[model samples]
Target: MADRSFLQWPFFEDRHRELAKTLDAWCADHLSVDHADIDAACRKLVSDLGAAGWLQPTAGEVLDVRTLCLIRETLARHDGLADFSFAMQGLGTGAISLFGTPAQQDEWLPLTRAGKAISAFALTEPQSGSDVANSTMTATLDGDDYVLNGEKTWISNGGIADVYTLFARTGEGPGAKGLSAFVVPASLPGFEVVERLQVIAPHPLATLRFNDVRVPKSALLGAPGQGFKVAMATLDVFRTTVAAAALGFARRALDEALARVNERQVQGAPLFELQMVQGHIADMAMDVDAAALLVYRAAWTKDSGAARVSREAAMAKLYSTDQAQQVIDKAVQLHGGDGVKHGQKVEELYRDIRALRIYEGASDVQRVVIARQTMGAFLGGN
Candidate 1:
């Protein structure tokens, strides 16, 4: 009903089409969750996703960006928390799946892939969010262990995760070069959930504190100084998936608008018959399709063996998220009073879409990335 035609695009293969169809059907039947208990809802969603083998891609030796995009798009369209649960599983353990040692992978991947454990990527701090180089969390090496001391805020699954792929300053050099990545279990001594953050849309988010928490050398994700690379690489894989999620939200908004305009009467005639209303639907449709194109293009580029899809991913994330916010706004306007009223689908989407533009990389940050990359290529430096 939402539109399966995108599956036939050249960016996707037969396998991707099948995945899209299968997941869409699965989401329709299984994505329903109680919003009153956010933690329980997220945990159950992750478990259900794992039981159905949907989280298997998160544990793969090589991340399939296309698969990640397709799943995120479909899940977001159905349920926001479902998308959050699935995306965090991939994002939290992404560093491990991409860089963890054999023993590390052996210990974590099975549980993560099976949905028996929740994972978090602890990178954002009170002083740093997009500015990874400004991170102040320290991981001091002490004999066979690294002692973590600092705090991370706005962390997805912060209070609920079983394991964390945490980035901290290890003094290898300066800025990003001095940082290191580690796999930390939530049960470590002195680690605490300082506070749970409630946002416009409900999901399990919190501020975490690490006070002299110790992890063995075996927890190091890669070489000590390669944490920046690890974080970037992981984000490179997941950023386009962010765009896919935005695309999903846009599509759902359009769908709700279509159904509303067709059924609602304005004066005596159907709202859909109005020329101005038709213009809004037209713009929403165009934005959805355009965002889908950009999302899939970035995903396909990454999956096709580009070492990194930074510029492409940034563009995809930028255009898709900004466009989606606009698209959802249009959907809300077309619904008149019902759009802003609580419990309406479009109203929920209005809340759901605001974060995509701000997270992973903000729209302004994306513009900087795109411009720098374009100039680098033109100047023969990239």
Candidate 2:
């Protein structure tokens, strides 16, 4: 079993511990199924998670970051796709939860929490990745509605979501300040799924196009010019959860490596008896623990009433994800040829962990965020 000792840390409360236990049991019981049909599997997984009431944390008032982190970590330890499904539910609806009007929340949150609806976050465009300020999607005001005309690629749940919390340029200024957020339903007049994206480890991803799709002014999330702030706040909450997911992957890799070394015999002795193998195990253990510390520290900071946690969250994501790649690599190395073989857990993990480093904010982008935040703090006192 993966380590449960992390729950004992002061960073967590009794409710957090209970949530972790419940989710671990739920995932073990419900997540065992063939994932060859990635789309079908994702749909079913989201429905099952919703039916079980696990998606409640993704919506509603009072989002507890600690609970979110614990859920992602527990789910990730069992299934990466399960983790993805759960994370997307929260991420896709985060804007609504944080800034939606009463009617908007009522219209969507219940169905979303019940798994009857899928949600997506439409932010990245064809021309923009991490550069949110450069987004070119336009939402032109026309009386009581805004007509959207642009394409969003690299969108999670792009082809299948029921509604998208979309960001578009609304002319507050030249950069991020000009951006605005809207909740656009998939059934809108001119919205289209341009392409279904395939990656190393598949989940539902796609490119979406909006052609004169009109949404009522009621669909606006927060004030017109507050979209950038809304997006940043949403990211700050979810970024630490990404680190927790990485910690889960690293822990599972360590467990696999440990089991392999004990079972495999070499030179008339077990592989665990070798000094070099022992060193690898030690390094894996340290990396897992260190990653856990940073992940929870960031989560705890957020839960303890920080308006934003860019520096803490960035460090957690950057270190935990980068270290997880290292830990998984070591696990694959320990397995020798079996590691790279198709259908192997370590092999799947190798693919699953890769995108975590790239998404949310890439590791390189996170370093820059950290450096800027650190310097801002140091220089602000003067």
lDDT of each: 0.94, 0.93
Query: lDDT value for candidate 1?
Result: 0.94
* lDDT (Cα, 0-100) at 214 in candidate 2: 97
Worst 10 residues of 1 by lDDT: 373-382
Task: State the lDDT of candidate 1 residue by residue for 1-382, as single tens digits.
Answer: 7988889899989999999899989998987788899999999999999999999998778899999999999999999889999999999999999999999999999999999999999999888889999999999999999999999999999999999999999999989999999999999999999999999999899999999999999999999999999999999999999999999999999999999999999899899999999999999999999999999999999888999899999999999999999999999999999899999999999999999999898899999999999998999963
Error of 2 at 212 (Å): 0.4
Runs of candidate 2 with Cα error greater than 4 angstroms are none
Tell me the deviation in Å of residue 70 in model 2.
0.7
Give the TM-score of each candidate. 0.99, 0.99
Clashing pairs in 2: none
